[model samples]
Target: MYKLLVIEDDVMMSDMLSMYMSGEGYEIKQAENGEQGLKLLEQFVPDVVLLDLMLPDWDGTELCIRMRQHSTVPIMIVSMKSEVSERVQALRAGADDYLCKPFSMHELSARVEALIRRARLMQPNAAGGQQEEAGQASEKEIKLDSERRLLLVRGTFVETTFSEFEIMKLFLTHPGKVFSREDLINAIRGFDSFVTDRAIDVHIVNLRRKVEKNPKEPHYIRTVWGVGYKYVTEVEATR
Candidate 1:
């Protein structure tokens, strides 16, 4: 049975979710404020956390970051705010996914299952089994210092956000593999997250500006023109 912790102040919504999720065989725990949520976390470690942004005690972003300080459990933000910037901020703050207000319960359940599955697959990465050697450049010759949240292009440090860093890490790790927008979203955020195309484009643009010598004329991240984007790898001609 998957344990779900819901940190929402809305009494009606919490009651509704508790009844529905309990019927689905998930152990449901509810907290009306961030302080209570943090307290409950000590006693009941949940498989996933359903968080609301408008907590009476603490702002949701701060709570999300605080949760990340101790746990990697997936956090799905259920908020009424649907702006791209708001979504970006929550994701960057360490929430695994975001769902806007007035969402379908079916979609919410699907997202919960997807997040748990992805988190299971990501355990290897979290345990240091899948990370590339820190401070070492791959064959493509780019170094990513995930510990420092830093990206190095040609041995020079460049500024990158959580979103940009994750996307760049995916591209660099896969080398020439093409990643569609949906694929990137699923990898960085969760499956079917509330991220918009504009958000992805913004991250791509920001990455280009930092990594490319000239963002307009890029040599590293290339657009597939109608498909998606891929990291360009230099091929040496065999003499």
Candidate 2:
């Protein structure tokens, strides 16, 4: 059974989520504040976390940042704040998805299901097999270890978020293919996620910072003027 950790201060809201998500067959754990939530996060190790932005003990974004330092579990921000800036902040803080309050239980369930599905897909190879490596082997060695969900640049592991990893995986698999912002958003978050096009730009920028020696003049992920971005193929990287 997939486990879910819900960190919500609202008593009624927490109860509602527990009841509804339980009915959906997810093993549920609740935390009324940030500190308690962090404790439960380590002990329970849930597959997905449903977090609220307004916590009496801690700011949701800060908590999200802290969580990212220790775990890669998918986080979905369920908050009353509907502003684009607020959503972007949470995403930049390491949230994988965002859902506004007053949401339907059905939609919440669907998003949770999607999160679990993606998590499973990204797990290390089940048979203890060799880690798959894909990338150019020229002066700059870029390697993708799917089993570890890690991106290695010049033999160094570059930390990446779930979305960042997915984007890189896609780029490495199909180098030289131009993917629009919408395409990337859909590919990583799926059509159900509440994400804006600008969010993709933020992800790309963050990714470049980690993968490129100098983000200003990116060599691997090139921006296609007027369209979107693409991973430079071996031949393209040479020029």
Candidate 3:
């Protein structure tokens, strides 16, 4: 069975989400604040994380940044703040998917199921026996080809670590698609790889510093106010 972590401050909200997800046959863990959520991540390697943007100790976006520094667990934002800016910011912080509050149970279940399904599909090749062909390709030096690889400022022969390359590949492949820390974790980590979610954010920061012209106000990797990061492309490519 897949295990899930839910980070929410509201006792009732967290309980309801936990119970419903539990009924779905998933092992559910709950945290009242970002601090506790980080601790849970260290102790329990959940398959997916249901993250809330608003937390007592830390904002959800900040938590996402911290978590991305360590892990790639898929994160789905379950929050009440529906502002476009908020959603864009969450995505920029590393959220995989955004879901507004006052949502339906069925919708929640579907979202969780989708996250699990995607996570399974993203497993490392050869049943986790080896790093797999994709990893090897990412590790091996290859020539820079913007059109072929969907790469932007970073070149194919990027002088960076494998973790940074993995994050870049995701953006290149799906330009303009927002990815939170949780999404980054789920998409990159191997099926059996043990890493914290915050670790993912560290990689993102490093990656930006390496590739972006200005990491602070980046042009290639622009943060969505209420969502996550999106790799903006040139107009010629849009056609």
* Residue-wise C-alpha lDDT for candidate 1, range 1-239, written one tens digit per residue: 99999999999998887788888889999999999999877789999999999999999999998988777788999999988888878877878789999999888898888889866755655445234444223433555765455787777887677678778877766667788888777676652355677788788888888877789987788888888889874331111
lDDT of 2 by residue, 53-143 (tens): 9999999999999998888898999999988789878876778888998999999999888888766754543221122322324624676
Candidate 2 segments whose C-alpha is farther than 4 A from its true place: 125-130, 133-140, 143-152, 155-166, 172-183, 189-239
Rank by TM-score (best first): 1, 2, 3
Indicate whether candidate 1 or candidate 2 has the larger lDDT: 2
Superposition TM-score, candidate 1 onto the true structure: 0.69
Whole-model lDDT values for every prediction:
0.79, 0.83, 0.70
lDDT value for model 2: 0.83
Q: What's the candidate order when arranged by decreasing lDDT?
A: 2, 1, 3
lDDT of 3 by residue, 1-239 (tens): 99999999999999999999899898989999999999999899998899998899998999987887777787888888988788767765666677888999998788778777765654542233233324544322222232222233434344544346556766655556788767777665532144455687677778778666668876566666655566654431224
